[model samples]
Target: MNFVKRAGTSLRARKARTVVLSGIFVVICTLLLGGFLLQAAAARQEADARRTIGVDVTVRGKGLGPAVADRLGRSAPVNRYNPVLPLKAEARGAQPLESDGPKPPGTRTGDRARHFLAVSGVRDSSMLLPFSYGSARITAGRGITPEDSGGQVAVVERRLAERNSLKVGDTVRVRSADHRRTVPLTIVGVFRDPTPDPPRWTPSHELPGNTLYTPVRVAQELGSDAAAVLSEAVFRIGSPEQAERLHAEAERLLGAGTFDFRVNDRAYRDQVRPIQQVGTFAGLIVWVIALAGALILALIVMLQVRERRDELGVLLAMGEKKRKLIGQHLVEVAAVALPAVAVAALAGQLAGQELGDALLDHRQGDVTPGQRQREPVAAGTPRAAVGPPAMDIGPVVLGKVAGIGLGISLVSTAVPGIGILRLHPRSILTHNE
Candidate 1:
């Protein structure tokens, strides 16, 4: 008989062993593929979260001024520096129109009309990013420039422009609480602040309307001397370790009481800790289960070989080569294993997608009331926010799953067949006694 007939006969005679072995192969492939895919999905999510929140170091101080910014610029390995001070300003004249709506008329209308927290000596490096509202772009306008540092130019948020019916080249009036002088700011650019979530304890929710972006000089011209004291300093560092070192050095140079500085290292650690812990435990469980499956399958294959010894010996006595017999058995195992591996890989992919969605929902649900309560709004109305786009499982992940599953199945079949290679024709058939 040919290899196919031989394989069929052997498998039929060992039906119990074949069924048990196939079950074990399926279980092993399922656990390994599922664990790997889930881990990969989690890693992708963590990376995206880190990129979204990009600040490396944030420094806050009472009496910290541009001088501190200058000193840090000179001393620290800073990629960028952002100096910020919060001050109130009255909107003076006509409201700029934003995509969302028109600015409501009030004491906060026009430049002198709205209450704005002005920044003094705003630097290029300090500008916030993704400066656009839902589906809006920062077209036809220029960002805050260094030459405009001491000038009366304003880069208003897109929503602010839409509400007030303001556009590029329009001028808004601003009044300083400390000084009676009114500053007329010509609109230079319209930008967006991606995060609708404002910092804690700030009034006028929705990223603070009447907010104007002007040069540091314009801000200093509007607020008190104490206003020049930098409220916060932002830095973009090259590496996490570098950020930590800079934080420590900043504490030494600026004095701890002078400022509260934080590095992204701690936040990164906190964010990844849960995922790492769970991944570790899950990996351990998967390993244990996979090992158990391999062991069980190994035992089943060995038992099947023992029961088929007579048939194998007869084949050998008929002049069939040892390699051919081994090949036949391998092909039989693969015929059984390949389908199981395919099913396991498909199951893993489906499970990964489900797990990702569940994780996202759980995270969103955990948002505190305080956090959700303070979301930015335009005209006291909430904008329809967009959800994160769906994740695409590309060929890379699918290929990996396919490769891993096939490899596991092959190893499971091959590991216990070494004894099959040593069987002797005479020893088995003649001793069939």
Candidate 2:
């Protein structure tokens, strides 16, 4: 009979032993598959974190104006840019949102007591920290885009809208802080702001609910200066490493040492570092398990060969090639490994979801206590810092597990068979007798 046929017969003859070996193989294969799935998931999450949680570069200088901001924004490294023009304007025929916190001591009672609305003019309202991080969302109409640069438009907070009975398509007039220029802005959109009042006493204009977003041009018109200028402009880059390139570009545009460039990478470090750590950990697990599994199976096969020396001697006496004898042993081990691959694939998929979630949840919270305040937003933002990765068991992972399982089987069988197969047929039979 062929060695393959004889290998099948041997497996059937020792049903109990085969079952025990199969159980061990299943455990080893399951661990290998799980490790691969986790590594793949971590890689995917890291890529997303790089794109969504990018680095923010803030430029501040005396000469940084609308023209310079536009030039820097068009640089190759910048993903998005927002030039802000902040101003204080009096709301005409409308009421600003009130703060629940206590008022400042001895507040003014007459006309001076009324605070001007806090207005923020931007090139793109959606790129602001609040909207990008998702702490704030648009409720109706559209955000103030670049097209509204010179147009008179405004997007108000939902609370401010309710206090003044304002809605989209309604015009609200605002007078400059110097009370020289009065501009009429049509309400383009209304957004919901979850930011709450501070614990300490504060002015109504400084409150979150009283803030307004408008086109940069509107702010420039309402501003006292004839030229359009901004105190600072924010730019987003793909990764923290790209911040250097951006710095160089800014230096080229605005001259080095003249402007203060602040690079904020807190969000990127908080979100991406943990996922990278997890991916590395999973890789270590794969190698350790693969090595240990091969060593264990090799020992088991060695002992089995010693106990079956009589059968090996008899086969050698029958003129069977020693290579065939080794081949038979290898065929049996591989047969057991073949079924374990499928079983492990199923087991891995079932366990990967729970394991992946637990691992990421633990890593995402690995932030230092001191760094919490420095983060762009607090914990309760709409999007999580690092969401759990999807546990997808793709063909690539399956193929890798299968390859490792078979490699383990080959090493286990070959190590023991070579030692015994070297003996002569007469010497092998005499030792058994």
Q: Which candidate is the best by TM-score?
A: 2
When summed lDDT is taken over every stretch of 10 residues in candidate 2, the lowest stretch is 366-375
State TM-scores per candidate. Answer: 0.60, 0.79
The candidate scoring highest on lDDT is 2
lDDT of 2: 0.81
Off by over 4 Å in 2: 74-77, 88-117, 124-152, 157-163, 173-184, 191-210, 217-227, 362-385
Which lDDT values do the candidates have, in the order given? 0.59, 0.81
The TM-score that candidate 2 achieves is 0.79
Error of 2 at 83 (Å): 2.4
Model 1 lDDT tens row, 1-433: 7887777777787798678767766776677666665566556555444443223577887656776776785655675566765566656664432223444444243342224443334665223422311222354487666577667898777677887888899988877775586889998887655545343423331244445678767777777664478667766554465776776667776776667876644434444444555556556766776667656666666676787789778888888887777667666776667677677766665675675565433243222111111112232211112133233455675565456545544555575568778888878977873
| lDDT, residue 157, model 1 | 70
